[model samples]
Target chain A: MTSGTTISGRPGISAEEFGYLAGGPGRAAEVAVVRLLEGGLLRISREGVVSAVASGAAGAGTPLEAYALGAARTGRMLGDLVKSTATSEAASALRQHLVDRGLVVSDARRKTWSTVRVLCFVAFFAAIALTIVFRVHFGVAIGVAVVALLLRWFAGRMRRPVRRAGRREVGRVKVAAGDRVGMVAQMGLLGRVGQFPRMYYVWEMLGIVPSAGATLRRRKPVRNSGDTGTMYGSSCNSCSSCSSGCGADNSGCGSGSSCGSSGDSGSSCSSGSSCGSSCGGGGGD
Target chain B: MGVLDKLGVGIGWRPEIDLTVERLPGVDFVEVVAENLHVEHLPESILLLRERGVPVLPHAVSLSLGSADPVEPDRVEHLGAVAEALGAPLVSDHVCFVRAGGLDSGHLMPVPRTRDALDVLVANVKTAQANLPVPLALENIAALLEWPDGELTEGQFLAELVERTDCHLLIDVANLHANALNLGTDPNRFLDEIPLERLAYVHVAGGVEHNGVYHDTHAHAVRPEVLELLGELRSRVDPPGVLLERDDNYPSDTELAGELAAIRGVLARHA
Candidate 1:
């Protein structure tokens, strides 16, 4: 009574029938029966009556006979194909293998590796975002993560890893605002030239530090850290709102690349990397 | 030790618990749902227990902090106000996303593990934290499906948020078990992997069976598997005090007593 369970009378009631009963809408008693059959707790005879199925036995009939008798359909099949010895945990893993291949539906049961992997990913990214917020270098953050993951992966191979799948996603960035950078200068003769307003029409700029419509003084640029007073922040990459989301006023500064000084490819830069994709992700810390 | 106060081991607040109200075992703490606070919810048909010494915790649902756009800042602000009024140590909300960019998933949809998403959670957490006096502790939700782009586990992601933001962890033991059951992972390993230092609270709730799937529907009594895992957590991780959650089927006080007794039994083994 390995993977296929056979029922005597109802010759075609596969464990799939038990799968439906175990999963489908049914009375508590009926569900219990389905569970018993599915769990290999019972076998059915030709009369359609149920009987206990021994847990320690090998296949007692044809695969279809095993199916009809309500044997463990998943167990023998996996045992034969993969390896001789398989624990319930291992069996569950094989079950997941089928689901992954789309042979079986996966919405019902949880898997340890998938759960652990997903949760670990969720926690890792969360930590990374926090690290980014603390201004930790992306390299260092990923480095630390790699070391930890390697340790865990190696450790799991040595010991039985508690496997589980968790589906949750969070990404964010925290950029320091409220800082000012460039100074304004009209394109006229040095120091305003004692002229009235509108004397210097060529005064285009970036980051008006002193006041409104001010021109920025050109300065040398460095990578990553703030050079021009604008602090960079990063979080869950998918932030929905920005202090000044895409709008008409974006023509000057906020539009980043579309302003034409930078390429549109480089336009959507935010707290961290170049932006331009849909920036809606986190709750915005 | 006893220095760690008990979390919400509230009256079962369900009829199943009611069955054994008179013979129910005693619990150390209790929590009343926000919906059941007023007479309109509890009604005169049910009498509130008179226990001044017992701690009462209030949990809220449907606060969509993960919504992309601002829906009602007032709603969030109001919930903060209530948690404050009640002197709750930590206000809890689900990590599931309810709406995005003004469109409703109509379910508690989870986001993918991208940097952009982390940013959103941090922003939302910050907003909620600023409004409330108490730190916000988010609970892990059970998801029937997953986003394709995820690169991390829910535990790792939650732990990271706690480590970075100083946010408290509300470890839901039942959710853990349900995840273990639904996702086919080793419960023992998951409990061990989570960063336990940030645990501020914990949850245990019963689940439902649908189409051979065990769902964290909060309908049944706290499953024994959940209790066993809680005990394991106590031994391995020194988790926060436990809370027994009975969301559906109003149970009698005595029935809740039994659930509490079961918890205490698990606790005694851990102790």
Candidate 2:
């Protein structure tokens, strides 16, 4: 649920600003903001900050729903100081999770266009496959492959050419394709950085016991209740190091997680561990 | 010789403890988490297992065979690659789903012990078997929750699965103990329900006490209750080997050696 705010000319608004926008603080505004944020019905940004690229409930049925869910989880983590991943890192984690799940999130306004692009990609692949099945002549097979690759390239290019529309859904906030793609890409990268955090979740899910390194020792219990009251607490405060050591924004406690730091910062994979490597960088394992 | 042929014990593979496993004398065979597989970067210990003639069988988590959705062919294909690499005698997965169409419960969820699930599981097992290099075995996981529409008892569910798929069993005695303690089901009756002849091995692990309920934590050495059940199974099933699973507070080789002494004492006295 999201809080609602009525802008003189806008449609969807964030819960954070809904209380201020509706001229008074109330439950409806808080709800409107949360629902809008959860459903990604808003696009947020400041004068110099990158736009808050959330969309409205209109994109619920599209692939962007995955992105929205990630955003919501990130937002909740943001609200809860759930150690590891800065708000931005969390946003990226949410984005990459959606991508790994095969959901390609884009601006809601460009939904129909992406749908067409996917269809063109499919049609191109189908042609190539069919040519192989039909035992097309060598010359013809090469032609089909070329045509299919070209069509795929064309579809990818079209993914970038969406006209910039100034229509603001979340109060005067206008969203665009570039912002959308950039957000999706940023999330993808962040998702990789979120590996340790997610690895935590996966082991928890599989009932696999975790590796308790010297770092995890002496963890104080921070329940979901620890949303505020302290700008920082626990391991982060005791050591001013970001708890995440991955990424953290200045606004949150320092647990080492900065939205911008990367886990693959200096480490490089060995040649055998490459894409064709056994760890299944290609998932063959 | 294989782990079964040697100390006749089943050991958990901790990539970190590979060298210790080789240098130490008592470990039988290691039940490698298919995740144990860093195919390209085989832990120096796995190579040692090979050098020392230790068998390392794989236990997988993501078969997702019992899902309502169609099984992904690539999953089995990848599993086959692991199976092919290890040449494990039996590849096992939890009796649960990893994902559904639009959701992931993120736990080893239990399936209803119904005819429908039986058919689904068998089909999934057959599919995995067709692609895998060895026979596929199914393990009985410690289920914390039950299906509202379950059609069979946990033992009956397992017996039928073994019958249908011809899959061997890696019955976790600790799991059965937890099931008994958690569900308040009698362990003797549960034991009588399944055919013990299909059991190739057994798993014993430690559990935690939460709200007066026992949960499989695998943190400590095998608890006393599970050891008791293992004693019972030793009398009845005469399973091949007993594996010790300690995932959390992995003691040093010396610490584990002490635990192994306790296990070998039981296995030997019974023999």
Candidate 3:
């Protein structure tokens, strides 16, 4: 049978029960599941498998119910399903329903703190205005502002993610130190002079350690034949470790040396179009 | 083709920094990220670069050419189509696997430097090469970690791959530096073994170090040492071209132009 088709006594579960199983079993999911189970739309199997009660002939259920049923029939584990986006949505909606109904306990301390925070911010602004206009003590104003910020920070410490409702917050993937540094560098924060100097030096400036910091200078201008210098040179000759044929013998195909810088006339190999014919259409390895 | 004749200096073309790219003076060519471009609707800035006769190389990042699984037909086809669409001189991808066993690692994974892995890479590269509209240049990638029992060095593996498959090498100097620092491989030894004649071009990008590991980040300023490495490679053989890659935290036009100028200055020094 299709997962949607209800058999007799298949444990009366609703969208809520399915959601609870699919979603995480935190207080939000738990409270929501209980409220919906009480509403008579949900049923629980003896095996604890949750499904929706047969509403009519075909046993059609809500999208959330069908999703949960399909997941269960496929033998999906609760641990796996909890991470799915569909489960998270169902759980969030159910949690919101419970919150609206006053079924779950709300945090009184958080609510009171939030109210106090708003008053504190208003007073803080007023203090700044007084300092600016009436020549109030600047240090006292600064102290008050610092104390207000600290109070808010402490209040924020008592907050719990599950206690809040609305948009579902998926946890961030832990970033590696290298990736984090790279990201900061990419954001132009590291590039700005004197910002994050230690980070900039350790990460961005670490490259200087290898090169021995030899300053580069422009070479003497040669005739524009594209023959800037001999392809093979004595540059590698100075190294005593140069064993793998790096010195004097690595001259490339000497075709491009005769070409002038003014045009592509003396060049032996055509750049893009020539390769298109060779590489495009067909070729064998 | 003589890569040096037309190429004086080039910058990697990213959509976010198109304005700065367009303003670069004496830019001989630009490397486009192949996966980002659709054959049907390529970005206008890239088209404009083509119109200006700046050679655009299709640098593919997702080919996973080192995977044990057969290279996907669609991916190869897409790259072929992009090469054709851009009229590219050559196409390039890393000689690293980004996925294995039907799961994507999301970043380039170092291939085990064993004969078996080499054989897999050879077959895959050959398959990809046959389908590509231009010659394929496989780049050496930066490995965050390496196999404990790797049978060959990075240079040996790449040289063998090039010898076996007749593909070109998109030698990323920064990657070589990163590998040398992080994995304890010899960079000069790497340069020594590789066939410099088959250089499709060169890639120079910015990177950083975190903790004790050096990262090829491509988001920061090019280090002087990287330029020194480029110069060292030049001392070995004259490359036809070199392209600068900057993937994020794009600097202002003035800063980018200055960096390009710095690259030009280095190339001139080596030339």
Identify the leading candidate in terms of lDDT. 3
What is the alpha-carbon RMSD of candidate 2 to the true structure? 22.6
Best prediction by TM-score: 3
lDDT of 2: 0.49
* Candidate numbers sorted by lDDT from highest down: 3, 2, 1
lDDT of 3 at A79: 22
TM-score (C-alpha, index-matched) for candidate 3:
0.49
Q: For candidate 1, lDDT tens digit of each residue in A196-219?
A: 664331112221112112211111
How much RMSD separates candidate 3 from the native structure?
Answer: 32.1
Across residues B3-57, which tens digit of lDDT does each residue of candidate 1 receive?
2344534443332232223234455444544433542233211232322344444
Restricting to chain A, the TM-score for each candidate equals 0.20, 0.24, 0.27
- What are the per-residue Cα lDDT tens digits for candidate 3 across B1-271? 5433456578998765564577678888998988888999887678878999888888888889889999998999999899899888788999999988889999998999999999999999999988887888889888889987888888899999999999988899999888888988888999999998888888999988899888888878888888899989988988878889998655555667777888778878877
- DockQ values per model: 0.01, 0.01, 0.01
lDDT against the true structure, each candidate: 0.43, 0.49, 0.55
> What C-alpha lDDT, on a 0 to 100 scale, does residue B58 get in candidate 1?
51
Ranking by TM-score: 3, 2, 1
Clashes of each: 122, 42, 10
